[model samples]
Target chain A: MTTLSLGAARAGVELRSFWRERDAVVFTFALPAVLLTLLGSLFSGVYEGSTVTSAQYLVPSMIAAGVASTTFVNLGIGIATDRDNGTLKRLRGLPMPPLAYLMGKVLLVLAVTFAEVLLLLAIGMVLFDLPLPASAARWLTLGWVFALGVVACSLMGVAASALPRSARSAAAVLNLPYVVLGFISGIYYTPIGALPDWVIQLGSVFPLKWMAQGFRSAFLPDTVLPQEVVPSWEHGRTALVLAAWCIGGLVLCLMTFGRRSRQTS
Target chain B: MTDHAVRVRGLRKSYRDTVAVDGLDLDIAVGEVRALLGPNGAGKTTTVEILEGHRSRDGGSVSVLGVDPARGGSSWRREIGIVLQATDDAGELTVAEMIRHVARYFPRPRGLDETLSLVGLESKRDSRIRRLSGGQRRRLDVALGIVGRPRLLFLDEPTTGFDPEARRQFWSTVRALDTTVLLTTHYLDEAEALADQVTVIAGGRVVAEGAPDTLGSRDVATVSWRDGREQTDDPAAVVARLTAAYGGPVPGLSVTRPSLEDVYLDLIGVPR
Candidate 1:
């Protein structure tokens, strides 16, 4: 009972702080939506030898891109800054469960990711002629794919925060790789199959690519499957790969959170 | 001694190869404001962190609230509060929001409004922590620490950098609190004003320990008058001589003792 109340209160604070920071909210939410709209229109034409319009192909990937950019940079930098400022130290000094603190931040991540996803989807459907999931099964698949992406990507952020020297550099240090991976994964304007084999293989190693694939499986019609690196939806492989990242990312988050929590320096 | 809030014996800690704390001991009685006085790098923070269970010690028998801090868990954590040395920056949390959030941690926390007013942040309740002055943030630190109504509160250098007015304001807030507080500070004057007992730790050992007024050896009293001044080892004798010379109580008479800083320098063998 204590844990629930404290956890709820902390999540409330994180949510409040998330939206209250105008620059961060605008950058995290608006940038992705704007990027999706801009890219979706600029490349409205279909790719070579494929009937799928760029709008349908890019929309699903951009949804994953939104979750990735927001969680990877936002959660990573948030944790690093908390450590640098002694806010984590202060929280460590409390009787509150550390998991409660983490749960609150995770809840905030999901909330922000939801808003980012909604804005992107709305823009995709309204502005770029992207279709909504038409069946109960399709909606369910989208729901779970989003859930998997959020958990895996956000935990990946927690692990990556260990890379930054301090809070000030966290954004630069953590965001660069996400930017590079986003570009390579065709989150911007690159087509997946159009990229060189090595670049596609490198993208495959990250959860971002798999997340895009999973979303594509749910959102894109069967006729458009050839554009993916797999040339088939590979739904089982998508779920397995994303789930593996979730479990592996969970282990990394625990390790990083534990080591970081014990830090007094 | 049995009712002591803290007891330590042969407390030792070494970081990498450098000795941070070497064989330190301390005993703080219940409800006493015990001040750990030392300069920077004097192992003050390390010693306090060990007691607060934030850091581990290499060799020591420690008891805080009757449980070894290393083994102490959440139940143990509930009995103590900590005011971390200010490192600045708490994001955009407002004064009230910060207090209210931390207040939810403890089993039975002090009232949010009560803690806010106690720290004299009533007017600044809506102000974000970034907008607050340094002293105001320190007060917020204290408010969060004591919101749990802890039996033992550890304040690690609560006022490291503060203007004279701000430091004085902070001292009053400390004085008004009802819990036993263990404050670490290098400022001798701060210790003199607030602590019921002062433990001077140097090179990770207790160099001196007693009430601030009685910690140093007896010394001469300095007397000043309108025209002249005198220092006599025996203040009573000086007073008698001055009274007799004036044929009554001395005129424009004033007495002075060495400030704690002076005594501290003497104890540490630093040339004044």
Candidate 2:
């Protein structure tokens, strides 16, 4: 339908707006890389007899970290600011298709997430000589994880857009969850499975844990970690958990968006 | 001529315990510019929002271009243009890019260059929205609104914060548009200049509706001269008599009807 195309076009516009901002692009891409390097260097020798380079472990974690930073923190704050500045109100008045507006945001988040993934993967390959997945299937699994991670994180960002009363407060609140999730899910350290039993269990309940797990399956070989813990890259569970997160996040975002629209109306 | 751009009867909306628009009725014909003049919180913006299909009314029979705006589809939205009070300025997109991007939403949109020229921003098309002056940004808002070639345009205080020269330029732009325009503003001068018919709303109801010159309908005219002023029912007779008494054309003399602002302020009641 023409309406659908228009909607997609609008989403394209939103995506372009994000890409045009140098500071936002730098923060989204560079910050995660910088943090990965710092954490990798700091924890280079924490575990004995561990063949995994800190950068190797950190690369996979940064995929999850990238989503949290870009999709959740960056997007959540940007949307809240849009709402506060009457941008949303203005858009609502246009001849724009409703789906187009939302699709634009989704496209933007997806593009940024993809870019982050690629950048992190490049850093791993060149700087740390991280091994490529041995087979096409392994690479396919990695792509699914990254794609689903983006969806889950973007949904969380949309839901979080409703929490803050202003742009400044929204940025602060969005950052807290991202930092907490990054630390808990092992984006800057070893997998949560290596932590205490309760910590791993708690982390598993969140999307970050499964996201990191999925990324780890792609980058690390079967010989690297305990078989029982890594489980030889279970594609089924990775797809299911990440899909569930995407759906749950979308539902929450829709509910919050509807509520906010009604309240403001 | 048969199509009414906007038609509403008994429109009502409430916010919690407060009633914002109560039993308001309006009928705007095609190609007519109607100004809704009122004090702040007189339900002008609320009424406009309802007509724009952005808000729901508690009770009403309302039609915009023969469709209930509350349930109007995307096709209906394409026919309406809304110039909001503010818009997104944080994006680094150039003015031309922003206009062209938004223009794609409509089935038939004005040319980008033409729209920019109409709003007097042709030279600044390459400038980022954030880099624009306040007046230039306001012009950009107008450019976006008209870019879609909407059949009906809703302008909510479009000239607020504009300098006098820019305001005059804006007035010309409004005059040039053939579409029906429904404007809400506290500026009586703006209403007088741009509106073909004026409706004064006070306390959520239409207090007066007529041509700007005759709203109060007082036959009495005020005749002023260098010495003093007097109110008379017959200004022509008074002027004729004055000419005879002065032995020539009356010196420094003028006859004035009550301005729209005077009638509006009087109807709304001047602050104590």
Q: How would you encode candidate 2's per-residue C-alpha lDDT over A1-265 as one tens digit per residue?
A: 4767876776667777777776566666678888776666666542334567666777787867887777887778878877887778877887666677777777777677777878777777887777887788778878888788878878888888898888658757777887777766656657544666666667667888788888787877765565224535566887888899899998998899779767765
Which candidate has the highest lDDT of all? 1
Candidates' C-alpha lDDT:
0.84, 0.80
lDDT of 2: 0.80
Put down candidate 1 lDDT per residue, A30-94, tens digits, no spaces. Answer: 88888887887788577666667888788899999999978877888888877888877877777
Error of 1 at B239 (Å): 4.7
DockQ of each candidate relative to the true complex: 0.60, 0.56
Candidate 2 wrong stretches, greater than 4 Å: A46-50, A191-201, A226-243, B1-3, B223-233, B242-256
Query: Interface Cα RMSD for candidate 1?
Result: 1.8
Instruction: Spell out the clash pairs found in candidate 1.
Output: none
